[model samples]
Target: MEALQSVYIPGSRFLPTKRNMRMKAIDSEVQHSIRRIVNNRIKAMKAEEGNYDDLLGVMLESNIKESRAREEILNVLGDQNVDTDGLNQLKVVNMIFYEVLRLYPPFVGIARKADKDITFEGFSLPSGTQIALPIILLHYDEQLWGSDANKFKPERFSEGISKATKNQVIYFPFGWGPRICIGQNFALLEAKIALTMILQKFSFELSQSYVHAPHIVLSLQPQYGARLILHKLQ
Candidate 1:
């Protein structure tokens, strides 16, 4: 853990080759942890009965119209007071994911180098200059997200991404423009599916043992761990 923490220090690369070796070890552990979580979710899904009426079912059935799918889902869940349809519920899930990303982006910062001289606003940058684009800084800016920028509020995204921020550039959790993450949609869908399945079977809340500290290595994660008290639903 100490070695992993050291890797986050600025200019840590200037250290000895032994330090680089430690980084590889920490990275491997991180990768293994992620794979374990994904594999467990996949195994659980596969073990489920073929008859599913939730989000996964909709996905598996394929080619259903958005509104029709929502209707089917609402029927399966027996939820009448929701007022909103399945599509809107999906939107709410997406917004929740967006809020999570805003608080803790996977790539906290991305670097870009200037190929030639350029001017933006009133500032000038010469060729061969490197720029650090700290996306998390923009994600939490008061001007873009209002007074509650630091707090978790998925409702802020109810209107959609374009209208959520003061400027479009302030909300790039997966990078922006042509250089954006190619697997962004896939990643989000994977998360959405897993979250849906979990929510379907269980209700959960933070346990007394839960810690709120978020630490960043390659990605943001709970420093102590996310301890939750879960209750299985009928």
Candidate 2:
């Protein structure tokens, strides 16, 4: 949501396109984010198992492992690897996930079909008309997020979803409704595992050349590549 806004909303100084372009921009971000999240999980799994097939291990083994599977779930443990801690330990990691969402929301807009004609903002929109919800605009709505909406802040979500969204239907990075992402659970779990491992292992800083420029093709990608420096941990 915030990420999509980074492209169109005024303060961000990004240009806007029609609704379809916005939707594509968001989907591209989502697909790229998912791949990186999965790969990171793979790396983390290897740290324990030496080899990891991830979900396959859970799906095929859960029936055999039963309730023990949750105990063995590393991603849920937050900062602690599954072997060292349990879901009770994952507060910080969850917070990080929320921040990632703020910085790189996966979708720009959501399209819906109107069941009946409706008057909106004073205009009569006919029935069967499609309504586009510009997630980018709602997310950066300062009235809802405060002036710091553009700034990266994980503490905003620390109070949880209601506080983060101001109890509105605005902050939908994975979308909403019955057709919402089925793999949301899998993707989130994977992201936590990967992000945790990366944080645990390194410290990073953006290079002098790094710039906050994004482009819209299918996804709002960094127009300039993400050039940064990572220092390995001892």
Per-residue lDDT of model 1, residues 1-234, tens digit only: 866666476876656678677877898999999788655544554564333355444333222222233334345444333333442457656777788899889888899998999998898999988999999999899977898788666668878888887447798889987799999988987776665555555556567687669888788788998887767766
Task: Supply the global lDDT for candidate 1.
Answer: 0.69
Residue ranges of candidate 1 with Cα displaced over 4 Å: 1-89
Q: Write the per-residue lDDT of candidate 2 for residues 77-177, one digit (tens) a residue.
A: 43455333453356655655665665566676779987898998998989899888877677777887898676545557778878788688878777789
- Least well predicted 10-residue stretch by lDDT in candidate 2: 61-70
> What lDDT is reached at residue 163 by model 1?
81
Q: Residue 192 of model 2: what lDDT?
A: 56
- Candidate 2 global CA lDDT score: 0.62
